[model samples]
Target: MQRVYISDTNIWIDFGQAGLLDALFELPFTFVSTDIVVDELNNPAPAGLLERGLVVETLAEEAVEQLFTLMAEHGNSSLADVSCYLIAKMQGLPLLTGDGRLRKQAAKDGVQVHGALWLLDQLVAHDIVTKAHAAAALQTMLDAGARLPPVDCAHRLAAWRT
Candidate 1:
């Protein structure tokens, strides 16, 4: 079975801006998102992602209440962010988020979290994208103002260039 991963809003924006949305969907995993996260994404992105097989999950009422509770505890996280975290936690799925606050909160809750760089690595490791292609995607993300870790980005860029 393909692994399922829950993605928040920022990761979508990062890949969309990087023009790597097509490449992202090429990866061998089932990508899911909360309804809130899908609603949060701007035009073309939501449609494009859905067409690429992005699953939009509607949370249960109890889960929605938990989302609000989580929001109260982690004030820095948006509703959409908390929604992704909650779903990931409940389903034992890894979370894809580039938000620092969300990452910290997810860590506190024992939810595994990853970002764009990890996704890029996955693409290369799965042979869905070439090393050079992954490098270019990373560069494009950087050029599009993605707030990825510079050192990690540099390390991957250097290694993937080989």
Candidate 2:
């Protein structure tokens, strides 16, 4: 069975902007997000992604309460981000998020967290995309103002440049 991951809005935007939205679903995992996160997406991406196997989950009442609790605790985090963390926690799934605050909080709560670079690495590792393709996409994301870690991006950029 493919592992399911709860994704945050920013990570979705990162993949969408990098033009790897189709490649994202080609990986050997299932990507899911709350409807709240889906609503945060720009028009065409959401519609296209749903057709390509993105799972949209609606939060249950109990989970919604927990989401509120997380939002209050992490005052700087958005409801959508907190929802991602909460859902990942509830489902025991890893979280795909690019928000530093959400990542930090998820770590504190024992939730596994990953960002865009990690997703790119997955694409290459799974043979869903070539090294050169990954490198170009990474550069495109960076060029489009993605706020990924400088050192990690640099390392991947250098290694994948071959």
Candidate 3:
């Protein structure tokens, strides 16, 4: 079965808006989050729906050690980001994240990264929602304080329509 690793913040927010967490309940995949990600979510900031209960937050001790070593060897970013990337690397799973910087860094490290736009496309492709619905959901996310890039949002909508 496919395994999906999520970063600290981005996917949680997007999934919260798009009801993606509910959809995941039906998929044959395991969801994982790192300790660092757990810390990020436990911040004073409000937690999204995805972060509220959907993710499994447990990391092997060796995995945590490996993550720290990787962060030290490579350029370090946020502990959460590094942990997410390291977990994906160790497990050979694709990371689900919407942070551009993290996505680029994951790619440079040869890790697979899937962002919100990709999730939108998958929702469209799977007929989980209509193109119009997805577009409206994107707008809803924007109105809810999500800072999605205009071009990326437009492209995702256009792709859905196609």
Tell me the lDDT of model 2 at 22.
Answer: 88
Give the alpha-carbon lDDT of every model: 0.89, 0.88, 0.66
Q: Which residues of candidate 1, in runs, are more than 4 Å off? A: none
Model 1 misses residue 33 by how many Å? 0.2
Judging by TM-score, tell me the better candidate of 1 and 3: 1
Residues 1-162, candidate 3: write the lDDT tens digits: 565656556666666665556554444445676656756764223344345444655677877777666666555356677777777777777888766666777788788888766666676676777888778777777777776678988787676556
TM-score of each model, paired residue for residue: 0.92, 0.93, 0.72
Error of 2 at 99 (Å): 0.6
Candidate 1 lDDT by residue in tens digits, 1-162: 688999988889888877778888878788999999888888446888999999999999989988888898887788998899888998989999988888998888898999999999988898888999889888988997889999999999999999
Worst 10 residues of 3 by lDDT: 42-51
Off by over 4 Å in 3: 1-7, 42-57, 62-77, 158-162
Assess candidate 1 and give its lDDT: 0.89
In model 1, what lDDT does residue 134 have? 85
Give candidate 2 regions above 4 Å deviation. none
